[model samples]
Target: MSKQHVHGSHPDIVKRLKRAEGHLQRVIAMFAEGRPCLDLAQQLHAVEKAISEAKKTLIHDHVDNCLDDAATGGPGKSARNVLAEFKAISRYL
Candidate 1:
């Protein structure tokens, strides 16, 4: 299903994030409706996992594209460019 829609980072990543968003919204609504803690926790866990997977996918794409390009380039990449990009990625940690 996700293989059909590639946007932003990747199709799968976007799909996971969209699912997580839906779960998160549902969780919020459940909270408003005084839903059970146990059920909320389970849904929240799914949302968390989805968001985590999306983050991992986004990072993977960054590394695969930007870092890979920086690593293997004839003259397009510079030390400053790679260093800046690495620093940007470091902020995620």
Candidate 2:
């Protein structure tokens, strides 16, 4: 399968990624400080959840703008292609 073409840069998406990055830095600092394993695990889980939510937001936006346009008879072939891509993405989640 091919990669889905994301439309434009989303500020919210960037913010989410930055938050995830901060979480990662925290995880590293915790490790360096020899923090409790449970605390580290919880932070890791939070990072994972944040990343997952960010991905969902992107997918939702793509569907709303690109996929919806295609489905509405904008271009038959392109619509089918985009629909397939969306389905593949759903599988990943």
Best by lDDT: 2
lDDT of model number 2:
0.85
Highest TM-score model number: 2
lDDT (CA) for every model shown? 0.80, 0.85
The digit string of per-residue lDDT tens for model 1 on 14-72 reads: 67888889889999999999999999999999898888878877877887777777778
Listed in order, each prediction's TM-score against the native is 0.73, 0.81
Lowest-sum lDDT 10-residue window in model 2: 71-80
Model 1 residue 44 lDDT? 92
**Which residue pairs come into collision in candidate 1?**
none
Model 2 bad stretches (over 4 Å): 1-9, 75-79
Model 2, position 60: C-alpha lDDT score: 82
Model 1 stretches astray by more than 4 angstroms: 1-9
Clashing pairs in model 2, backbone N/Cα/C closer than 3 A: none
